[model samples]
Target: SLRINKGMHVDGNWPALGAAAAVAHSLGLTPAQTAQAVQIAACQLPMSLYLPVRSGDTSRNTYLGHSAQLGQSAALAVASGITSPGNAVREYAHVVLSKEPEPFDDTHGFHLLQAYVKPYAAVRHVHYGAWAACMLRPALDPDKIEHVILDVYEEAVIYCGNRAPQTPLQAQFSLSFGLAAMLGWGRLDPWVYREPQFQDAMLRALEAKVQVQVDASWTQQQMRGARLRIECSDGSRYEQEITAVPGDAQMPFTERELVDKFLGYCEASMPLDSARLWARQLLVAPTNTHPFPFWNLPQEKTPC
Candidate 1:
């Protein structure tokens, strides 16, 4: 199967495309079947296209995850002899890409790998906000920070305009809340979007300090890029511009890092040793194995 953006392209859309192609190939589908699967996956999981277009949202972080799952499902459907309209991509182009009512991309060389990944979990537009928070942390005494003035791309303001969020989930999509979370917690994690922290007085105070603005020069082409200008209580100012968020393929995660993340996520639900062993075996398991032993391991419920 051809993976358009399997290698070095800055576009964030590549992950979904690559994932769909990978799933189709793994399921032993034909080229046409795989392409159809990819189109279906893209349509079913429009987060890549929609998430970025919208202001910062928590769902944006999981867009690729949705694509991956949908791709797997689409491939399975094809393997099960389910018929699709065969014009998945054409339909997508008509409904999604083109303003017109018809799909028109016949070009084979077009690839999606041009996409990038956010190093932090917050919205792609606010990576620099997080970075600015970190940079300002050392310069200003947290107790004395009176206010923060954030000057970012106009699109940033447009995307993350929700200033006051009543819930952590909402806060995850709010620029002010994200900057506040980063400042108070020093990191952005799944828990940062949980209850008490979302309601924390200190975090709320920090959130109150953050202000956003837009820059006319910042264009849609610069999706993951941001510029942060911070004004502090002590009359100190700090400014930084991030061209690309970390964890992009250019700044790829190491294999060990990937393994550690996988272990961290799965170890709590299963015995750590068992999980590790199962993972290791699965990594090297031969194709001839009809029933994978990993699936037969004791199943346990994990916290969602």
Candidate 2:
């Protein structure tokens, strides 16, 4: 009755339902119709696995993109009078997949407030170690570092245990490489997942030094934590243990920080002034008439 234990890809499994509900609501469907769309989406969802991720093949990346398409398709299907079983979600979960999906009462409020926005590009499991590595980076000399050890919760090891991962997506799921990226680049920016960083002498060297181990007690308690210990060639050791990463529900990023992150990304593709205007229009003004001001941003001219 445990889908995670059965190796379901949690990433793709959940987004489809959320997307379906979102689209259905945006289409001005009634509550009952939105429920129908979500139910239909759930019934058609795949029992995805981690094969592509494990093998460094990018095929699995399509699953989430397909999930978005599936969501829109399901909403459209409902609009076109496609009816789903009354208990399609529960039946498919308990009977077909032997899954016991968590029940949410939603009594108090929306769960969107509790959502986490990642400061780094890696999985949530990899963030703790990556953050710790970033902290120790300023103190350590990369060339003098002899080895690094990461003791993390059990599931972190299971889902993010890739050693010397060969591909960008594979590295995204790698605990060792994420930590190494932080140490080498002083931050685990999305760009570090590229082939050149993977081929970097310092990153490759540091990545090879990283050893991942399971902290059995933490796993038994189902705790999310990471402890990083770096052993230097000169016998100087640096260590840090983190119980929570930034941007988590308990330690959410401030509004200013979040806005800064948005500005940073937008500025990368456009002028700083344009990025500021876009942010102010979209986020500050709340103008419905000029929705998505990003479209009006400057575009480079095509070569004739």
For model 1, residues 1-304, the per-residue Cα lDDT tens digits are 2112212112334355567677778767899878766666655535243433333345555656665666677777666666666655555555545433333446776455645545455666667778667766666565666667666676566556667777554555577877877778777756676677768899888888876766556654545455666665678777677665555656665656555655655644788887777666656667654345656677786310
Best by lDDT: 2
| Model 2 TM-score, 2 decimals | 0.85
lDDT of 2 by residue, 1-304 (tens): 1246535567676578888888888788899999999999888877778777888897887888878888888888888899887677777778657767668565788888878998887888999999888778899988898988899998887788888888888898999899988988887765686667667988888899988988999989989999999999898999999998889988899877777777766654888887777666766675554646565687786310
Stretch of 10 with least lDDT, candidate 2: 1-10
Candidate 1 ranges with C-alpha deviation above 4 Å: 1-23, 38-88, 95-119, 153-159, 220-223, 254-304
Clashes of each: 12, 0
Error of 1 at 142 (Å): 2.3
- Residue 204 CA displacement from its true place in model 1, Å: 0.5
